[model samples]
Target chain A: MAGIPKPKLNAGQRKSQRGTEEAPFVKWLLITVALLFSLVFLLLPLVNVFAQAFAKGFTVYWDALKHPDTIAAMKLTLLVTVICMPLNVLFGLAAAWAITKFEFRGKSLLVTLIDLPFSVSPVVAGLMFVVLFGLQGYFGEWLADREIRIIFAVPGIVLATLFVTFPFVARELIPIMQAAGSDQEQSALTLGANGWQTFWYVTLPSVKMGLLYGTILCIARCVGEFGAVSVVSGHITGKTDTVPLHVEKLYNEYQGAAAFAVASILALGALLTLGLKTWLEWREAKLETLAQQAEQAITQ
Target chain B: MSIELKNITKQFGGVSAVNDVSFTVADGQLVALLGPSGCGKTTVLRMISGLEMPTAGEILVRGKRVNDVPVQKRNIGFVFQGYALFKSMSVADNIAFGLLIKKWAKADRDARVAELIELLGLKDLAKRFPHQLSGGQRQRVALARALAPKPDVLLLDEPFAAVDAKIRQELREMLVNLHHELNVTTIFVTHDQEEAMEVSNRIVVFDKGRLAQIGTPREVYEEPASEFVARFIGVMNVLDCEVREGVARCGELEFPTHGVADGQRLRIGFRPYAVQVSNDLMAYRHFAVLRHTYFLGVLLRLELEFPSGLIIRARMSKEEYARLNLTEGRKISLQIRQYRVLAREGELLPPEVSVTHHLGPSPGDGI
Candidate 1:
């Protein structure tokens, strides 16, 4: 401490200090704009739907819950989300691992292909799957000949949901995996850990939180999917209609109350997702603190 | 425990980072690969630890060829300069990483982790995360992690570079004691000559992807094979000289020569502390102080100006300074406590120059 003297700030340094003081204000301004946009565009609509759904007291809630069509749509949406979320997570992990952890020709092109669905219209995504597996599409003829239904059926709805939500997990995971670097994996290899052990003990643990967060987002997207599911589902009552599609069908039939009731259920899922996001952020912070302390103890 | 690197060469897109560098580390001996930045000291360590494979040549551990062996199979412990502790694990878990990898029983792993926790003085902080610890503590965890496996060879890459100066000293002492107590073959890479000298039993001086010199710390310091080694291991004053009649003449002074014929031109070197200063320039020996006195705790260093205007440093103890009453603008006598006569074709001296001189108090002289 005595060897090196701290220099006093000059006029330029003082000006830079003033700039630093104003930086937080600029950051806060941007955050306020984002929060305002979400409140107006998202939270407001959700609140309106919930207020309408509860306006008739417990009668409307029980009536919607008892409706056969409403229950069927809810059940189908939950089933699709349950099936699609894990599939997307697996696909995302594989795609991210391939793009980031391995070297191959056209890797950039492959990444672009994985992200194609994000830029494509959801209706187009559904049509692309329809062309590949619909009754008159490529594999549709063979499937129909075998009496195996795809389009306008439950499987078709699930496939369309899968396509629309394809990139969610991989999109979240690739950057995190790349940022984590291969140092941990290399360290594990040097420690005599076989490939599987290295993955389970080191690589997987490092990316587990990222994987879970991405999976949650995937589930949210899968449950709320409408455009793609509508294109392939054919709106079969008590069968292929999902919750979002069911809401649209009810709204068109002049059943505004039932529409609002079903919309409220999906809205509840959005709230749950927000809660999951917050929990994931807290876990990330906790992990970071643990990492810092481990570093300190090691160096000490 | 001896390690041998035979003609090991690593090239990156037409540039050879390490070129045909060969050396051996005997069992239980600590060797430092000393060099300037980009001299491939770290590359050599990485190759030895199996972090990077040599593009050409073979690596043998204890006389067994292991060029293609995977890093983990090599059983070598590596401590990165940044101390790469797993951010997700606690101090105890980080140390147990290798033990867990080895599939040691839970009881054994726990016991080993506890032993290391105590050994590293982290028993109280075992549950702590890496971020909560200081720089020195992180370094200890990295060391403990590397040592937990009881590796065959330990490789450290600039281990103390990240720590504060105060902690660096403590870590250096800890490393010296650890090396002795563990008796593992250790290769430490550092650009700091003082650290290398204090921590290593032997030094391998590297320059431009080549082995400049390799010897014990005393050998390298006393008889540096080249000017690079001389300037690198410690402070030195290399003066241009001419050898004649078993003596090397530098400016106005002549000193006894080594390994060169008369009339051959060469370079002469001496340690700063070997030079003596006096008020009466002509009354003393064949040396002269140039200008300015520098205070280096316990010693006074004077920049001496030869007749040719070349500058050299001279160091004297405080008691010597008190007795002599040395000050700025005062004349002084200089001598070499010890030095090396480098070969002409060697990296230090030009081929046209052929002799060198080392002068100092003769053997048995207390001063």
Candidate 2:
């Protein structure tokens, strides 16, 4: 009877507060429309990828994944990610440190240049690399004389992936580093720590979580890059072919299940990356709440 | 002098943030750089700490010119306003960062950390991260960390600006006690006049990127060097008046001037504490109705409006208010005991030019 009476009271109270609330009909309509939109555009595509991958059987899917070409593509993609992650992290840390901690001429221009990869088309990036490193392009004769093969090789794929994923880590880190400020670094310096020591102990640790989050995003982008890598890879079967290029080649040759199987691996990787990002965000929020609680404790 | 800034000037792209400001901190003495926001007090503190290089000047620590010395080699302690404790580090670790960098023995470093932790009353918070501590607690941690290295000089930039009012008072007392106990040369920047006065042995006031006055708390308060210092340090009633014959008149208030040209405009200022009030209308030479009463704990600040519509603020104790039975709109007699002839902005006036006006018979009516 108490529970029943509570609902009745709540109903009256809600009706009294109806001025601030949306109409029930409009609310439900919007919710339903959003759910339907996600189901059609997001859920269906994801489900279709898995379904097509396993349409024949698990054996066919397993066989496709075990193919030498697919194995080569996986290894190549992993290699590229391993090579690109450290370089991008280094670049991101340097760029963020410089932009946030100092005043210099053309700082804004440097920031805009760091974001150039994000705005420019990946195809254009790959084409620029080819023009620079190809046999008929600038520095081509010099490179030929040294017997250096860059475009249409594993190095080309790595370069393409690097260019396409350049901004991910830096973009993630800039706002965090900016908000954290240089006070800690100054404190470190005043505490008898030199520049490199201060950065290693103070600045780097302060932005560790943000750097990790950014690195994850950068890795995800590096793993999935297609357009630029495609232009520079030259479709070399076991040498230059990345995961995406291999998937494209399999599909073009009517190996639909094989292609979808490889695509599912990428799709699964993206889902895992999303999960990691969400977890990082949750941890960051929890840390903030702890800080807020500390403040509240002080006020109390 | 433990720290001496000689003709220090810092310019950001030709816009000077700190002008040719020079000051010295005696060894083991506490000093404050006090001013309003954007007045370049913090810039002076930063230059001393070697955080910012002065475009033109020499910084000497213990009589050594340190303009070319890097911050790390300077061996100074600096506390930022935000208490920039490393977020990832525990309280103990943050305090020991400098010691570790200096390569102190593990046992000695631990002893120093424990000593600072106990000294700062952070016994139970040794393992707690920066985010897990309160603002006041974080401020103490920052102070302890700065003090851990036992540097020659300690510089703080607006140290208590981030804490609540009540906690700010506690931190001020803690800093004063710490400086006394350690006997370290300390210079802190603050815009709060009361905080500066309450803590430091001497205060250096700034106005528009230039040093205004540097003196003991009493000297700076009682004998302000300029009109800016007079108004900025505390509440002062300022009036612009023209000299007529031998008297300077603004409204109903008049001050006798000596050797001044007639019709010469002058700015004058007096503190509210200088205005004496009495309940009886005939007790003083002038009378006015009380306009407003502002309660400031033990003291009451009353606004007295003259018959000519000139209002002046007078401060008295609450006990005196009760004794006089003073209320808003009550008629009261008031007298300004002293006032200073002020110089215009950017003009220098000797602080000793304060004029004393005694209550005597004048040509005007006693009413």
Candidate 3:
């Protein structure tokens, strides 16, 4: 038998034969385009907000932060978050548990309804509350008879914000809970744990990471919401205005420094959320690696 | 009876999952619900454990009807198919979960967990989370957890289905030993016939949501009441033949009609071990050429091809194969020593010939 001689090639041909990657020039061109795209659309706007806020002297920026209206807006924002976070978390947990852990009629439709907020326009969400609670809306006469106000007030602002951010936590939890399955809960039940005990000890702990991730996202979204809160706030500065609505009011009144300064706070909140998400991903990966090492040690 | 299921039927969205299934497990006996996947064996186990409700039946646990009882209150330990060990809890915590739920004192809970850890050989894994343990280790932990509460009855769903073959064999032996030591009324579901036969004292076979047979392993293996059981339990060569004159003829193979009407179609099944092969072509009345040989460790499976395009599986020892110089494509003579007339699909078996009958050559029949 004759031995087949190996083929020889130059460096250029050898590189082409190594993999299915594009040519060097094409690869670099694509990377350059993507980097420039992010720079223009993402990095530029963020840098501009901080840059414009500090363009004035430090005293001006500090004064903008110290303004009574800005303080009220910050407080209102925090108040809305405090009121909405727990409600949303409880609702999200219930919704996700029902959808993932059991089979019933209209389950897929319920999942779609939970995601309705994400797809519906924020202004429409605001209008939905207005139509329900406004003076001319249904149950409006009964509410007016009781002298309770909802639309065009702080309560209205909270309601609109809740509608817009309703799906965040539930969306994050559904896939996590679905993937983990109902087996552990069933196992807990078979071990003499009642329904509540199974949920607390087995289901909740398994999905805590996803729940935390979702809470961070929901808080970030709730704090930064604009269109819905603005529609329902009636531009009542120092009373009903959240951080986003107040920022818009400041910019509209030619208070550019104050608006940019207020905007930077929300930007920082987003940065912190991103950092927390990264930390969670890192910790989860590290835990997975440790588990793998333990398993390998057993085999060894 | 320790547990009795009477006329148990389960329907999912109008489709029957289990239909008219009835069985009883004596106290301190290990029984296996054996069937293929989607055969409702797992559903039967779940209904017994009170995790699933039977659509129309009565489940009696130690002579008490428990149809409406919740799973937690049923006091039945259930091991899920996937083990389902709490990923967030350590092995000791998982085993102690049941004991704590029962309001046992901390000391007693710890003592029980320690005893189970020692019994299941999980001493070092007590502190490790479920993710850190191996598949076989996780299974042992699940078993220990289910057993920790000292429930009167224990049910397992495909307990060894997830492990590798070698570990599966080891786990089967461990379960047998554990059952012997703890003498609890145990019922386990498995699709592996060998596991069911090796682990349980009694086997209840299922076919398409109905109870096909319930008997000892030997009875089910030797005298399968239906055609499905005969094929599902082990390797059996089933042939469709028509009786002509005094014999049932299937291509080149013939069996005694066993009192069947002439020209009537009959089904006969014979085990591979019943196939007797001789090196001399004239030794037996029938001849076939060896086509393929499969090695199954100690036993050799031979596929023999007759002239009429019929193939039959035969098993022989390695020593006999070597002594007779049997190889593929070699001609050999074979005879079927025993076979049974299998009941047709959905038909009841005739009591007389349901058991296999031995046949000898007829007198004055020239070879």
For candidate 2, the lDDT comes to: 0.88
Residue-by-residue lDDT tens digits, candidate 2, A1-300: 666555445676766755778888999999999999999999899989999999989999999999999999999999999999999999999999899998899999989999999888999999999999988889789999999989999988898999989987888789988998888888888898888998899988888998999999999989999999988889989989999899999999999999999999999999999999999999989978878887688568
Q: Name the top DockQ candidate.
A: 3
Question: How far does residue B20 in candidate 2 sit from its true spot (Å)?
Answer: 1.9
| Residue B349 CA displacement from its true place in model 2, Å | 12
Give one digit per residue, the lDDT tens place, for model 3 in A33-113: 999999999989999999988889788889999899999999999999998888899999999999998889999999999
- Per-prediction TM-score to the true structure, in the order listed: 0.84, 0.90, 0.91
Model 2 chain B scores worst on lDDT over the 10 consecutive residues at B358-367
Q: Against the true structure, candidate 3 has what lDDT?
A: 0.89
Chain B TM-scores, listed for every candidate in order, come to 0.87, 0.93, 0.92
Write model 2 residue lDDT over B1-367, tens digit each, in one string: 3888899899988999999999888899899999989999998888888888999989988898999998898888899988889887999999999999999999999999999999999999999888778889899999999999888888899999998889998999999999989999999999988888899999999998999999999899899987888767766777667788878887778899888888777778887889989999889999899988888788877777888777777788889999999989899888999899886323644433233221112111110
Per-residue CA lDDT of model 1 for B1-367, tens digit only, reads: 9999999999977899999999999999999999989999999999998889899998888899998888889898888888877867888999999998888999999998888788778877788777777888889998899889889988899999998889999999998999988899999999888888889999999998989999998998888877777766777656666787878777676668767787776666667766655666575665565577667677666667765565666777888877878777666665455655553423344422222322222211111
> What does the lDDT come to for candidate 1?
0.82
Better of 2 and 3 by DockQ: 3
Report the number of the highest-TM-score candidate: 3
